[model samples]
Target chain A: MRLFDFFKLSRRGPTSADTAKQRLQVLVALDRKGGGGPDFLPLMQKELLEVIRKYVEIEEERVNVDFQAGTGFSTLEVNIELPSETAKMAV
Target chain B: MRLFDFFKLSRRGPTSADTAKQRLQVLVALDRKGGGGPDFLPLMQKELLEVIRKYVEIEEERVNVDFQAGTGFSTLEVNIELPSETAKMAV
Candidate 1:
């Protein structure tokens, strides 16, 4: 199923998943830029913060980025908590 | 928008993105495991592959995992083609 389908099937509804998914989509598109390097987590972290700052005011300490390698696949996770008041507007 | 909301607002249907979103969501959850680390791209890549392998067959070369840091946010993208045919069924 596509993310939309999952949303339709979801008991929680798509509106709820939108923010997270939007963030994820943007994140994934950027991560695909790596070209045969050790890993771009550090670079990604730096650049990601730069991008977010351009669009939104944020707290530097709250942003995070990482890669997790699994047996069949690997995952990258980026966590960000904008200023509480800002997050509410985003919500 | 949440993932589900994006699906509804999407120009293309979520069914197509479902495979990608499902993959990304799984990847993100896994990536959240890192704690005070240099970067877990390698470990995330390994563990992700292992998890995918347990459920489905895949081409090792096709699987990708990385972190992309932006100004305010960062993202991880994992791309995997599950043996072509398997990807179809998942669809």
Candidate 2:
């Protein structure tokens, strides 16, 4: 692979920008594929909480989800605070 | 519904925090369910790109996806720039 390409792959971890992109990607994927049914968002919200609960402790109320528009693409954003020291340490 | 609950639902929009939260949820969903094999990330990246492309114009190279660890939870982030004025106006 080219040097720049290799560098890009190697650098693919937690960065503010990268995190933002991933969030947007997931949101759009769900919005388009999840179907905007009445229960869809709630189901997504429930499923999201369930999935997150497996990996990290979170404040159920503090959790937030949204959709955003940039220059051309729209993003779905998810944010939650971790609940454990061990979880942070594992990362 | 209680006033607090009503406010929460009514206020939900393209807020930055909400967007971030959605991103994290989607990423985790994919990571846990996407089965991170050699092709997983690439497939996710491809699928993400495809989904985003349907609704917005993006800077292909500038597009980014990442994963992050917060207090206890981890997040997947996706970021992309829109290519057309129409996409932003539609939001």
Q: How many clashing residue pairs appear in each of the predictions shown? A: 54, 27
lDDT of 2 by residue, B1-91 (tens): 1212222332336655334322211233222221222213333445445444444445666556665533322334454433223132111
The list of candidate 1 runs beyond 4 A from truth reads: A1-91, B4-26, B29-37, B70-74, B84-91
lDDT of 2 by residue, A1-91 (tens): 1212222332336655334322211233222222221213333444444543543445666466665433322344454533223122111
Model 2 misses residue B47 by how many Å?
0.9
Question: How do the residues A13-73 of candidate 1 rate in per-residue lDDT, one tens digit apiece?
Answer: 3354333332222223111112222322333444444544543446656666655543333
Q: Roughly what TM-score does model 1 have, to 2 decimal places?
A: 0.31
In candidate 2, how many Å is residue B50 off? 0.4
Each model's interface RMSD (Å)? 15.2, 15.0
Q: Report the C-alpha displacement of residue B3, candidate 1, in angstroms.
A: 2.2
User: lDDT, candidate 2, residue A69?
Assistant: 35
Q: Which candidate achieves the best TM-score against the true structure? A: 1
Quote model 2's iRMS. 15.0
